[model samples]
Every structure is written in C-alpha cells, then in structure tokens.
Target: MTDEATQRLQDAEEHKKSYDGIMGAATEVGVPGALGLTMMFTSLVMANGVLLSILAGVAVYVLSHIIVKMFFSHH
Candidate 1:
C-alpha cells in the first residue's frame, strides 16, 4: 500500500480504538448511575404503587443503555 493509504488505515484504527475505550468507560459509569436515577425518579414521580414504579425504573434503565450505545456507536 501507498504511504497515504497506510496512514489513513492507521488513523481509522486509532479512532476505532479510542471510540471503544470511551464507550467502555461510559458503560462502566453510566449503568449504575442510570439505575440509581431511575429508582429515584420512579419513587418520586410514581407514588401510586410499587410495581408500576419498578417497571418504570427498569424501562428508564433500558432506555438509558440504548441511548448511550446508540450515541457512541455512530460516527
């Protein structure tokens, strides 16, 4: 391969590695934080019942993971 092609490939690999590291870090911190926030929000907002609140909290947690993954996975 030419010098420019090799350089571009190296740059792409570096970028991918950086992105993976960032996503890994985000997952490490974001999950527990999201769970805690979901619990808090559910408790405060859905005072009507326990089951519904727990369900809402789970939904929030799942949504947070999805959002984080989608945001980080894309360029």
Candidate 2:
C-alpha cells in the first residue's frame, strides 16, 4: 500500500453520477405511467384492444432497459 491511497479514495468519492438523459427519464416514468393508465382504462368504461397490447410492449421494454442500465453501467 502507498501513502497516496487516501488521495485515490477521495478522488473516487468525487466521481460524478451517471447522466440520465431525457429518454432515460422518460422511460423510468413512462413505463409505470402507461401501465397505470392501462389499468385505469380497464377499470373505467371497460374497453380493451390495441392500446393495452402496445402498453404491455412498452412496459417490457422500459423495464428491461432500466435493468440493463442499472446492472451494466459500472466502470
């Protein structure tokens, strides 16, 4: 171990957080939003069709994207 180890630790602590761009923020919110809206539509007025199917696809994509971004973003 060297005397500069503490300095290295300090530098590591100062590292910047990962950037969540516009699309990233959108996915994180949009996935749940779509899922909720679908549920609401199903509950009220009682209608089902392509809207629900599309929301399902979006939900899956967003969730997988989030998982991949979370687990594989390390240096």
Span of 10 residues, lowest total lDDT, candidate 2: 14-23
Relative to the true structure, candidate 1 has a C-alpha RMSD (angstroms) of 5.5
lDDT of 2 at 47: 53
Predicted candidate 1 versus true structure: per-residue lDDT over 2-75, tens digit per residue: 99999999999999999888879768567746785768576867575777677767777777777777776755
User: What shift in Å separates residue 47 of candidate 1 from its native position after superposition?
Assistant: 5.7
Off by over 4 Å in 1: 46-75
Flag regions of model 2 displaced more than 4 Å: 1-48
Clashing pairs in 2: none
Per-residue lDDT of model 2, residues 1-75, tens digit only: 575998887666655322445455655666556665655555444554666655655665666667756864673
Question: How many clashes does the backbone of model 2 have?
Answer: 0
Cα error of candidate 1 at position 25, Å: 1.8
